[model samples]
Structure formats: C-alpha cells, structure tokens
Target: MDDGKMVRALVRAALGRALRCDPDRLPIGLKEEGGVLTLQGEVPDIAAKRRALKEAAAVAEVRRVADQLHVKPAVRMGDGAIRDHLRDALIAECAFQECAVRVRDRGTLESVRTPIGTVRGTIDVSVDDGVVTLDGSVPSLVHKRLAGALAWWIPGSRDVANALEIAPPEEDNDDQITEAIRAAHERDPLVDAVAIGVRTQSSVATLYGTATSEEQKAAAERDAWCTLGVDDVVSQIQVVPPTAPTRETRTA
Candidate 1:
C-alpha cells in the first residue's frame, strides 16, 4: 500500500517471473528496506541459489542483494575438517600444485602448499561456519571453476563465493565450458575421460558416448554441470558394461 511495500511487491513479482514460479511457492525469504535486499533460505543446489540472486538483483527497486542463501550440504562437517579436506583436494590437483595456496585459520593465513615451480598465482581459501570463500587469482577459468567445484564438493560447504580472477583474462564461452568439463572428467577417477564425450552449444552440454557403468554415466553428467558456464546438461551417455560390446545410442 505504501511506497516501500509497492517496491517490495514489484521485486517479488520480478523474481516470480524470472524463476517461473509463484513468489509464494519459492521457499527463499526476501527482505528489502531502503532499496537493499537480502535473500535467505536453503536452496536445493548452487544453481538455484545463483539464479535467485541474479533475478533478485535485476529488480529496479533493489540496490543490491545480500546472499544469505545456503545449500544444504550432503554431509555435515566442522569448519576445521572442511578446511583441511579442501586444502588437500586443491593441492592434489596438478594444475594447482604450482600455485601458492593458503587457508585461513584463527587470525592468520596458513600456508597449505608452496609453489613447485615459478609462482603461477595465489589462491586464498577461507571458511566461515559452513560457507567457503575463494579469492585471489588463477591462470585460467578452468582453474577457477575447478576450485569452485572442489569447494562445493566439500561436505561442509553450505555456500561458495568463487571470487577468483583470471590473469590475462580469456574469453569465456561454450567452448571453455566444454574444455573444463573434459578436464574435470579426466581428473575424476570414476569417469573414463576418453569414453565420455562432451559437446556444448549455448552453455548446454550434451554428453554422449559409452560408459562402463551407470555410475560412470551419472558421474560424467554431474561433472559437466559442476563446471562454470554450463547452464544445462543433457545426458545421452549409454551404460555399456565391459562385457557388452554392442553400441546402443549416442548423441551427435
């Protein structure tokens, strides 16, 4: 009825339109005052949280969106355990072993890994409660996305703010998404990188080819979605056991 209420209503309507659902149907909470909006709730996944923030921020009446939305982690863990696990995952990756990686503990930044070669970049990792924030610079978008994915995979990471920047910024497109997916698959032990093929158009990745097990097929698809820039994924991966040599169907 008043100006503030009207603005709030408009913002809700915009979010409803963007999400293609009734604002009431959306589980997230929205609070707006003096044009600053804060979103809070548990979303199903990272993608939904990101979509909510993007759509809410586009509202004409909203100044900025404070993201308090959290993804319910699959496994619960303490901050210390999460920090240790995340550090290990990053260090194990050959791409990141050359980068200076540090994790924040207590009041100081603790060194996790010293660069093996010339310093490629710096990666600062910090965890608060269940939220993980990645900052600093990386050499490529693939590295950035990989780091984000690794963070999200952590059992206690309720939210990940991937603020890592790429030095000598490269153009990001569907091709980059495809490359990242392939790289992820190569690193994933469950997936046969050569067996699962990726093709992307407009950020939608179509994964076709043959997989040894149903788990492998599913893992390959999940890897595609975890990569940055992948909006949607269509899994055309056929499960072919090692004994079954017959080719089923594949997407071109």
Candidate 2:
C-alpha cells in the first residue's frame, strides 16, 4: 500500500481502538497529507470530540491532527444568537477586558471596543451554523487558551475554532492547559474547586479530590475537557456529601 493509504488506515484503526469514542457510531471522516491528518464530522459531545482528535493524532505516521470536528449542541438556535453570545463572552471575560470585540452580522462586521483601557489586541468572533470561530491575536498563549476555553462554554457552540495568535509567540506546555482548567473550575459556580486539585502531564489533566455530589464531580471533568490542548481527562474525584454539624447538649 502507498504511504498515504497506510497512514489513513492507521489513523482509522487508532480511532476505532479507543473505547470512549463509541467507534461504531462515529461518522468522522479523515484526510491525510504530508503526515498531517484532518478530522471532520459531528461528535456527540465535547469529550468525544477531544477523544477523536487525540486518537487520530496518536497514529505513528500522523505528525499532527487538524480538528474540524463539531459537537452536537444540546439546544438549537440561529447563527445570530450564537454570534452575539460568543461576542459577549469575550467582552465580559476579565482577561479580555483590554481586547476589542467584533462580530459578523449579515455579512457586515460590527465592532465593539472596550472603553476601559488601550486596546492590547482584538478578538474577532464569527459564528456559522453552530461553530464559533475566534480570530485576531492576543498578548500571550495564556490569553489565547483562555479565549478558546471561554468560547467552548457558550451553549450551542458546536465547535470552537480558536485562531487567536500570540503577539510575541510565547512557548507553550501542559502547564497552560492545567492553568486553564483550574481557572475554568473556579469560574464555574457548579464546581466547588476548593477541594479539587489539578495536575497535567502531556496534555492530559488529572483531577483529584472530593466533590460534594456526583453532579459537581462531572462538572469538574467537563471543565478540564473544555480547555484547549487537553487530549484526555483523568478524573479521580470522590463524592462525599457534607454532614450536618452536631452540637453537644448543655446540662442545666
């Protein structure tokens, strides 16, 4: 077999081997060129989307995996609503307070500048279908990752195409993802991040600690996966309900 065909086969096999992806139901398509494989299709959820990308990138012949995968939204809405929400998310984000916001409206772009301070950079948001694309640039990799993570949080966001580039092009590592995950946990009211500890190794985040309930545990896991560069999430969180305090009776 030719090199191209062999690489494609290996990638497909890798995806099929991953147990969490529900390989039987996965309808993702693959394309390969110059050792780079591209994944294109709709996935059930964010977990499945990240899992598919990780599996495809793990192939020996695949040097990099391009993500074109979209997660199915829980609720359906028009493209305009998605654009507005994504734009608001960027503006309201404290880290992005210095960044300008723009949106694509009926082919015309509406620009919204922050009055707080000088514009460090801009984040252009455009939504097509359910996919949200972030363009322009940022001051550092941390800002880029934070913007990407926030985009994924918007409801009905099928996929976040984070194209935000760093102005000075800073180096990146697993620490970036770990920090992003921790920040996400802190931002999310659903998660009680005080008891949860985060550790990242090779793009995999392990969340270990205790949650008050099952829902909180799951929320913590979801926060980890939402961050960019997260290949997989290892959740070691235990659920322990809070106990009522018992007071000793005083004898008169």
Candidate 3:
C-alpha cells in the first residue's frame, strides 16, 4: 500500500518465518515506521520474547527494535510436571549428570551430599506461582550455576532464584586460584583466553586485557568468579573491536 506498510509487512513476514515453531501459541503483533520495529504481543516465555525481538531486528532495513512482548504461560503446568520436566532436562544435559534434581513443595527443604566432595548441604528445587527456587549447596560454583540455568529452561518457569552456595574447598593460595581462573578461561569456547590475563590476590580474582566483545568480556569475568577459591572478581577487561589497530601495529 504505502512505504511504511510495506516495511511492516516485510518485517512481519520475516518474524513469522522465524517463529515457525508454535506460531499459534505465540501471538505477536508488529508495527514498523521509519525503520524502527515495535513488537507487541504475548509469548510463551522469556526465550520466545527474546526470539521475537531478535528476529525483528534481523529484518533488512530495521534500524531498532522495541520489545513490548509479554510473557504468559501457554499451558498451566503443575508443580509435579514442572519438576519432572526439569529433572529430565538436567539429566539429559552432560554438564549436569553429576547433580541430582529433587522437586519439593514451596516451604519444604531437603539436603543431599555432593558426589564431587564430601560436602553435605541441600540441593532442593521448589516451585510456586510458576517461579522456581533452587536452594542448596554444591561442591563447585559451576554446578550451582548449571542448576539455575536448567531450571530456567523448563517450561512454565517464570523466574528462578538461585541461592545455591559453594561448599568450602581446601584452602588454595592466590597463585593456585589465578591458574585455575586461567584454565577456566581457556576451557570456555566463547572466551579468547590468549587475550585475557588473570590475577588473584587474597582470594579475589582480577581480569585484565582486551576482549573481542562485551559478551566475551563478561564471560571471562564470569569464569573467574566461578572458580572454586575465588571470593570475588574484578573485571578490568576492555572491549576492543576486531578491526581496531593495535598499539604495536599503529605508526605515527
């Protein structure tokens, strides 16, 4: 019809194709004017809302994306079903094989010993009003984070409260903690370990160097914070564009 209408139509078509899965369940509306897209509608969960905005932004000529998508549970799931689904999902993931998932009532508490260390604490999962709370202790911070992420992946999970604590490990000096942080950065595929430098002092780890993007910088800091003996993490990493010239290569 008109230029604005045509742009809206193109963005809508692209979003429809991107959200092919459960299109009926996820209903989204779009408005585009002057290359800006505004998304409005209800999505099944946070992931679907993010996907809608991301797809709209990917459309050609789209300058900016405004997200007005609401999160509504497509299907009301009982606590038991949510628990079973979360447990199965965690078990299916290779990273969480060692951790066990237990579903409990909102007020109930349970304790279990972790297989990694002789750490005895609670690893309980409870659901209330579609909010999942992961409360307990784990031998390592990785397991604690994994539990929270797995809970979020479950359907009908509106929010997650990860209160899992890391059990005390044998005391390690600052040098050992620094090496562990370095090794962690190297192991993560998203982080450029060569560009990151890790240092630890009095159980506090500091990350210094350049990262390709903000996400990479955050990941490097997260890896450092997740290290066993790290009490805190200070991120001094700078985000540098790949095309930016280095100081050594720049000529006056």
Candidate 4:
C-alpha cells in the first residue's frame, strides 16, 4: 500500500471509533491522491453521515474530506400517535405534570387552577405537521411563563408557539366600597345607623356628618380610611353634646 492509502485508512479508522461502530462495518470506500481524500458510502442514518465527515477532518495529513453519504429513512410515526406522544411530553413537564393540569379526551384544552388565587383557563394544546402550538391565558406573569414551559416539553415538536395573555386583577368600585362601609357600620357597636354620610370621589373619601360621641367620630374616620381607593381624608365630623341648656342673658 502506498503512503496515500495508509493515510485514508487512518481517517476511516478514527471516524469509526468516534461513532462507536466497527471500522470494517462501515462500507466506506476511500480515494486519496496528492493529500486529498474522497469518501463514497451509503450511511444507515444521519448519525453515520456526520461521523464519517468528522473523522476525515480530524486526520492531520489529509487536506479535505469530501462527503457523499446518502441517508436512509427509518421508522415513521403516525399522525395520531405523534399527537398522543406530544400530549404525554407536555404532561411530563414540571409546570403541567401535576394532577391539577388535566387534558380533555378531545385534547382541545387543559385547565389548571391553583389555591393562590391564580387561574389558567382553557389551554389549547395542538400539534400540526410536527409543530406544536399553545393558546391560553393566565392570571399573572408567573403562570404565563409556566404555560409556555409546559408546551416546550412535548415530544416530536419541531417548534412551540405560545399565545397567552395575563389577566389583570379586578378592581372594586365605589358601590362596593359603599356596601362595605354600610356593612361595617351595621357591625360596629358605636355607630348610629343611617346617621352618618360617607362621601367619596374616585375612591378618596370625606366623612362630613354629625355623631353622638368622640368614639363614633373616630370609628367613622377609621372606616372611611380603610375603604379602597381612598387617598386623602377630610374629616368635618362634629360631635354633638348629649345635653342642651336654655339660653340666659348675663352681664359681662
């Protein structure tokens, strides 16, 4: 064998080692001339194609590895099976793996609601042509990220696309505050029913009414401050005297 043939053999051997396959098992033919190596072979899979090229490049004496490896297709997954596999993958993810996250038989949606007042409603998990798409909304930024993370774990997914919105917490309006104040007044022992008027503006409030005692005045002020959206307080509350006396004229 000439020096060129020896160099080609060394290249093939190094590649076979990296691939963990027998050097003789690979039916790769090599052509070498003027330090350039030409490779011709049919690889069983894409892994073999990569291994062959890598081995050739690692050869110090060889200037180039010309790859001509044809790849063969192996097993094919059915559409329904692929979808089922992806569903299982999604379920295994830490975010959605728990018993709380459950998928419907139709696979149209998944729902997860936690005890922390966070809600995830109607997550649509679907895969088409190896691409996975998740559509849903959560109550906060944390749950939104959780939903996306869950989608990525799906098997056979070429790519995952998430379309989710975080819903803001609902706000209580003036009517609710008024109702709460009325309820508080009914519960308090010091408050005179229907005698106090609680006036509000954009949740900021002012208590301008009369009360029988100083304690009642303080309680009314406390109630007004606790109401939601009350920014500033203007207490014009007067404490009425329990007893009234007749007017008498006196010389000073």
Candidate 5:
C-alpha cells in the first residue's frame, strides 16, 4: 500500500482499539483521508458520540475529526419518558440534588413539576424529539456544565442546549475577573497558564498568548468565558506549533 493508505489504515486500527471497550460505540464507522477522520454510524446518546470523536482525534497523525454519527436510542421512548429518565438521573447526582429539573415537550411545558415549596434553584429541561434544552440558574459554571452533561447522557438525547446561568456570589471588578480566569486556566490540565495572559475590561475578558494547538487555544477561551461576571471573551491567542521558533528567541 502507498504511504497515504498506510497512514489511514493505522489511524483506523488505533481508533478501533481505543473504542473497543465501549460496546455501544464498537460499531462506529471510521474513514481517514489526508489525516482528516470522518465518523459514521449511530451511537446511543450525545455522550457516546462525543467519546467517539475524542477517541478518533487522539489517534496519531489525526488532523481533524468530522462527526456524522447519529443518536439512536436502543429503545424508542416518548418525550415524557425521556423527561422522567433525565429527572431521575439529575436528582441522583449529588451536585444537582438541590436543583429542580423541569421538563417541557416541544415548546409546551410538561406537567411534571418539582413541588410548590421547594427552596432550591430551578433547572428547566425541555425535550423535543430527542434534543434537550436546559435553562434556569446554577451556583457555578461547574453545575451548569454538569447539568448539561447529565441531560446529554440520557439514552434518547440527540443534543443539548444548555442555557443555564451562573449565579455570581458578588460583583467582581476587572482585576478579580482576570484572577478568576487565570485560576480557571491553571486548574485545567490542558492549558498552560504561564504562557497565557489574561485581562478583563468592562466585564469583557481578553486572552493573549500562543497555544501549542487549536484545542489548547479553545480551552483557554472556554476558561475565560466560564469565569463568573465575564460578559464576553475576546481571544487574541495564536496557535503555534511546539517546534516553531519564537520571535523573542530569534531576536535574542
């Protein structure tokens, strides 16, 4: 086989091994050309689909991954059934136990209500077809992401629209916001906080620095965007390969 064909074959084999443990994703189809991998076939939920893409992208020499996988629940369920399943999952999670999970069908609100006197915050869940929408407020960005992940994990969920707001403890100044962004970046293993400069002005966070890859750049932006009180994020970050020489080094 030619070099191109060999590379593609190697990528396929690597991806297959990566997903071998997950029976639900074992049937996913993979095709690679010019280092770009395309995923086909169906998975049970959005989480499975994301896992497949992540596994494919981790293969050596993979430049990009295109997701064409569909979400097909093992058993067909109505909107009501899907909502109940999501509610049970949310209430069982320690992080979400204090939050209410409401379900809506299409644009119409469903009758499933969390009791009248519940004091905890509200998290509204809407289901249309298999797609889910999460709205309301959470104490932190972590909770918002957790809620969305839970919703996406449901068997029948095709996608998730997470609109959950993060309730800031108090008003934060630009400096505090910048510090928060920096802390978030430092906490994330994928980001190199030392290389990234964070600044906030008028509730907008701006990031400046060079990242080793597009994924790292995006992770930095996400960290800034998720910081409390950050109204917007302006990413001035550049993607530079690890082997590339820096201008400062060249001048020195």
Candidate 6:
C-alpha cells in the first residue's frame, strides 16, 4: 500500500537525484498524514533543503510540502550576504556586459532585456557553501546560456542552475541562404586569391574581379558557378591589359 513511509522514501529518492547527492548519504525523514507530506532532512545547504521540498511537492499524491529541513553547518551561508555577493559577481562578469539581465541584492534578478522589451521576473538565488542556484526565466535560450556562463564566473560560485528560457534568434527571409553563400565563398581559395567581390541576390551571384586575361575571367566565373545555391553568375570582371602602357613622343 502507498502510505506515508512510502511517500517519504520516494521523496528522499527523488530529491537525491535532483540535488545530485547520494540517496544513502542524504539524511531525510518523511511523514504523511491527511494526504500532507512533511519532509525533514539535514541538507548540506539551504538550496539542497529547498530542492528536497520541491521534489516532495512533485510526488504523485503529495498535497503539500512541509519543509522542516535543517541546514548542516558545513554548507550554510548568511542569506543576505550571499545574495549581495551574487549580485556583485553577476554584474562584474565582463561577459555579461550589455546583456539585458540586471543583478541586484546578490542573486535577485531585477529585469531582463529581450527583443520585445524588458520582462519582469522574480529570481531566487540560493547559496550552499559556494554553489549557486540561479532560478529564473529570461527571454531566450541564448540569454539562458549567457546567464549561466556568467554565474559560473562569479568568484565563489562552484555550480549553477540555469533555469532560464529565452527566445530563439530571429528568422530573416534570406539569412540562411545568405550565410550559406558566404560560407561557400570563404571556403574557396580562388575567391580569396583574385581579390574578388561577390554579391548574391535571389540566388544569382555577381562576381567582380580584376582579371588581366580571358582565362582568368573564365576561371573566376567558373568558381562562382560551382558554388551551391548560385543559380546564375553575372561576371562584371574588368580585364585590364597585362602589359604596362608605353609613352611615345613623336619628333617632327
């Protein structure tokens, strides 16, 4: 039968995985009565204890999470001080320069910038010893990764929880095709050698190069034709005289 003991055991098992702690090493007690679950544990830090409570709350039949968990001495930190440090660390990370996320009061997130505009969101920062938990949402995946990377660079941060979601990069009508064309041009040795200028519109590649012979002009056009997605090539190559001009003075 699924009873309180079973519920507590399940909660401990789940939280062990969530916080990446050994299940046997995690000291937790679970009690359930009247469909409510009470979680008791001595977690290394407040973050781990909170994670335990969250895991219990997600249990199939858990009505509520009574977080009676205690913080172990080894990993405890002053909540206010930790928050302030996190704020300073986040702001000081040079990689986050010009980023939309605002850090304040340690790890409390104030605002996030996005293409649409600023977003109002609450960020919870919990520190256990030196590990940091960044729980918040930004606007896109790029922002999420950026914030996580920044968090890791903080002086005392040993780990980070990146629970942010940001919008994907915008889609432009011709961006992919244009990028592919550029990549192809970059890979070709002839494109680099001849001091050629290539511009593409509607899959048609226009190549302008300084060619001194018909052979050089043909070779340049052929290079443009071979590039994938280049449906047509308009050669605007100027083939100047290969030999230098000689000045002549006539004597009467």
C-alpha TM-score for every candidate: 0.77, 0.86, 0.38, 0.29, 0.43, 0.34
Model 6 clashing residue pairs (backbone):
83-106, 84-106, 87-106, 139-166, 139-167, 140-166, 140-167, 141-166
In order of listing, the candidates' clash counts read: 0, 0, 1, 1, 0, 8
Q: What is the lDDT of residue 165 in candidate 2?
A: 85
lDDT value, residue 247 of candidate 4: 58
- lDDT preference between candidates 1 and 6, better one: 1
Q: Where does candidate 4 have its weakest 10-residue lDDT segment?
A: 96-105
lDDT of every model, 2 decimals: 0.83, 0.83, 0.67, 0.56, 0.69, 0.55
Clashing pairs in 2: none
CA lDDT for candidate 4: 0.56
lDDT string, candidate 1, 1-252, tens digits:
987677668767876776678987777887777767888888776656666777777777778888899987778899889989999999988889778999999969988778866988889998988899899999999999889888877877898888999997988988888888898899888999998899999878899999988889877876786677776678899998887334553332
Candidate 5 stretches with Cα past 4 Å from truth are 1-10, 21-26, 30-38, 44-51, 66-74, 87-102, 109-122, 145-165, 169-252
Superposed Cα deviation of residue 180, candidate 5 (Å): 20
Between candidates 2 and 4, the one scoring higher on lDDT is 2
Model 2, 26: alpha-carbon shift in Å?
A: 2.5
Model 2 lDDT tens row, 106-185: 78878976546587888888888888888999987778877887777778889888889888787889887788788888
Candidate 2 stretches with Cα past 4 Å from truth are 1-9, 20-24, 31-36, 244-252
What's the ranking of the predictions by TM-score, best on top? 2, 1, 5, 3, 6, 4
Residue 225's lDDT within candidate 2 is 87
- Candidate 1, residue 200: the lDDT equals 97
> Highest TM-score among the candidates is held by which one?
2
Name the regions of candidate 3 deviating beyond 4 angstroms.
1-95, 105-123, 127-132, 135-190, 222-232, 244-252
Task: State the lDDT of candidate 5 residue by residue for 61-128, as single tens digits.
Answer: 77898767767774677777878898777776766656666666656765344645644567888777
lDDT of 5: 0.69
